[model samples]
Target: MFALISLSDLENDFINPYDLTQRLNRFVALEYATQVVLVAVLLLGGKWFLAGLQAAMLVYLLHSWHVKQHTVDATDVFRQLPVQKKRRLIMFGSFLLFFVIITYRFIESIIHGLLTEEGRAHAKKLFQDAAASVHGY
Candidate 1:
């Protein structure tokens, strides 16, 4: 099958010798390489996106603050705001999506780092101890 051949190719390229230590070392090396690539992309590709988001949020906050300062009542500014349900939903959804993406990335990094045999063993022991305490086993 094609999948088997692809797996064989990857094995030959990256894990041919079936040595755990070598594989772990290789994984760490690749992780460093990926970190470099991610830093480069964040610097080059993410800069503009971050800047635009910062500007938009800053402008909105400043406008709200100015309105509050000018008004005598604290809740006056909020009362004057228009209820654009569609825009509010879009912003809320986008924020939730961003949070989910960040959380997923964090979990992925943790799982990937703990994929090595030693790391897995440590994680297993930690979880087992926690489970034992919870179950009073």
Candidate 2:
């Protein structure tokens, strides 16, 4: 994984048609990347920014459909793959899917936890100030 990311030729790395087909790997990678970005923005409290990013990603994917048929091409990728590579691609894709989902959930929990904690602290402080004022402190 480290070596994969460190590779200078990211396009070449992602285009592997053997163990991990470019279609499956590329699609998963792009989705995972977008999800991570979304969660990161959510953690940073950039709700509006994340929404805009989502809209942009949607538009980009939609616009690119005319140039390339990813779904049909994915079938070709599968058909051309050797048996062993097909098995590996299936296992790798399943694992990648699980990892992406788990990571997103974990990030979501962290963001929710942070926001709830902050809200509680803010309410507590507000209450303390109100009580102090009432008591002329």
For each candidate, give its TM-score against the true structure: 0.39, 0.29
The candidate 1 region of ten consecutive residues with least summed lDDT is: 69-78
Clashing pairs in 2: none
Alpha carbon lDDT at 89, candidate 2: 53
For residues 95-132, what per-residue lDDT tens digits would candidate 2 score against the true structure? 47656766896889767765887867876898899999
Relative to the true structure, how large is the alpha-carbon lDDT of every model? 0.48, 0.51
Off by over 4 Å in 1: 1-56, 59-83, 134-137
What is the alpha-carbon lDDT for the whole of candidate 1? 0.48
lDDT of 1 by residue, 1-137 (tens): 22223234433564342332232234434533543454466557665554454345445435544654212122232232222223334445545665676688789989997999988999999999999899975
In model 2, what lDDT does residue 16 have? Answer: 47
